[model samples]
Target: MNINKQKMIRNVLEQHSNGFYMQTQFVILHNRFFAGTHVHVMLKINNHFLVEHFKYIKLLQMILILELIVFKIAKDLIQYLKIK
Candidate 1:
């Protein structure tokens, strides 16, 4: 959600050995997930889909972990609580 994280995700995807399709899908999937309920999109993916997207999976893991940590640790939470 933040610029730094977005930039980092982009870097990871861009640097991947896979072709452009996966990277483009990565961006689309990320936008779709955060745009609404990511759980739903995740549920739609089967193991076959996972295998298809295997290369991006690790990067997705990193993005998800970073996202959770950011939401938990970022000062944006203070703004939400009007604590600033």
Candidate 2:
């Protein structure tokens, strides 16, 4: 993510009632997901997961949808490699 976009997301997140907590959770989840970790497990570990808090947070929902798309592509690639 570019600096401006990062700033925008931070700004939006900071506007939430639980801004600091939400921001911290978002960063942690994002880092773990991009690091190739299982997002489901991370969410489970974090009890107060983002999904529950993200219902009204469109930006987060959009980001997660994109991440899911990337994850699907990666999974398909691995399956294809195994088939070869």
TM per candidate comes to: 0.30, 0.35
Candidate 1: where is the Cα deviation over 4 Å? Answer: 22-25, 28-84
Tell me how many clashing residue pairs each candidate has.
0, 0
Clashing pairs in 2: none
Lowest summed lDDT across 10 adjacent residues in model 1 is found at: 43-52
> Candidate 2 regions off by >4 Å?
1-3, 6-57
Residue range 1-84, candidate 2, lDDT tens digits: 456655776565456423223424444234233334234312221233334222223466545543553445456657877999
Candidate 2 minimal-lDDT segment of 10 residues: 37-46
lDDT of 1 by residue, 1-84 (tens): 567756775676456423322323333335433444342212111111221122233556645643443334334446656963
- Provide the lDDT at 81 for model 2: 75
